[model samples]
Target: MMKILVVDDDPNILELVNIHLSQAGYTVMKALNGFEALKLVEEDFPDLAVVDVMMPGMDGFTLTKKLRTEADIPVLLLTAKGELEDKEKGFLAGSDDYVVKPFEPKELLFRIHAILRRYDKAVDLFIQAGPMNINRQSYEVSVGKKVLLLPLKEFELLSVLASKPNYVFTREILIERVWGYDYEGDEQTLNVHIKRLRDKLEKLTAEVIISTVRGVGYKLEVSSS
Candidate 1:
């Protein structure tokens, strides 16, 4: 499911978006200010964030700019400011879209869809396997409270395995899926990548294990106990 973070000082707006967005089948999290939102980003990486432009400590513009340096997730600014200059400044601050206050919820959703179409990955932008949360769009994976910075190939390999937990992926299948059909590397290549991936994953949690099926491929298995 695509997770969305709603950052607004107004409790009413937060509740409204939570109720409506959650009803729309999206996981919703809220923060009354930008600091909380930033902390949540480290905890749970959302596919998109709806931020209000005016707040106490960190306004939406500043927050959006800060987020740009943090993650690749899309940011949509919600504010009463409708001036073209303000919109330009918002865009300059790295907001994907701006929704003026008193806007229709349907319109908000529509705008969100437009942003997703432009910025998000495939429809399934997120994946959860055991304690690991993966965001395809942001290319971010969090294992429990720790956010891992994995290399490209390692990230893709983990994403492939995590997509279907405990399902054995044959060596050939893993190569085809992760490295592509015309991969010039041999099975040894897969082994090397798996070792690196295992090292990183183990650093996060030893409870999460990647098992190698002899003569087959690999499967991600996590302990329940």
Candidate 2:
């Protein structure tokens, strides 16, 4: 059974999530705060985590940062504040997805399943774009004969875009495809990842392989080089 760790200060929220997740056939674990969440993570690694943004002693943002350094476990942030900046903060902190408060239990379950699907698909061994090669199994990328180490998200984002060259994918599409439909990060997250990808590719060729369409989205150019 897939294990999910849910961290929230509110008892009602935790119980509600536990009930839904349990019914969906997931083994649910609960933590009332970030400290307890961290302890739980150390004692027993979970397949995913759902964390509330506001908590006593170490907020969700800090917890996410700490978790990212040690593991690639998919994290979904829950926040009462539905501001764009809050979402951006969660993304920057290394959350894989987010959900605002006042959300339905069914919606949360769907988001959890979506995130798991994305994570599973991301494990596919390899993807190639022109001379560039990405080995998902090893989490390594190379161009021609040169090896390039990329951050986790950068690799996933590039792989998703390159997997379908010449297709323009909007920010929302990329987020859903690469980060999962539960992802609530701002479009700026995509821009940051794109910039990183471009910088890495610059080492291989002067020609830009990924092109951005104004008011549309981004696409990978079918390169003849």
TM-score against truth, every candidate = 0.56, 0.54
lDDT of 2 by residue, 45-151 (tens): 98899999998888999888877778777899999998999999999999988999989776786688778878883234677767777787788787767888888
Reference-based lDDT, each prediction = 0.82, 0.80
**Count of steric clashes across candidates, in order:** 0, 0
Runs of candidate 2 exceeding 4 Å displacement = 121-225
Per-residue accuracy of model 1 over 122-213 as CA lDDT, tens digit each:
25668888778888878888976799888888887888787667777778657755676568877888899999988888888876789998
Q: Candidate 1 at residue 120, lDDT?
A: 47
List the lowest-lDDT window of 10 residues for candidate 1. Answer: 116-125
- Model 1: how far is 26 from its true place, Å? 0.5
Name the Cα RMSD for model 1.
12.6
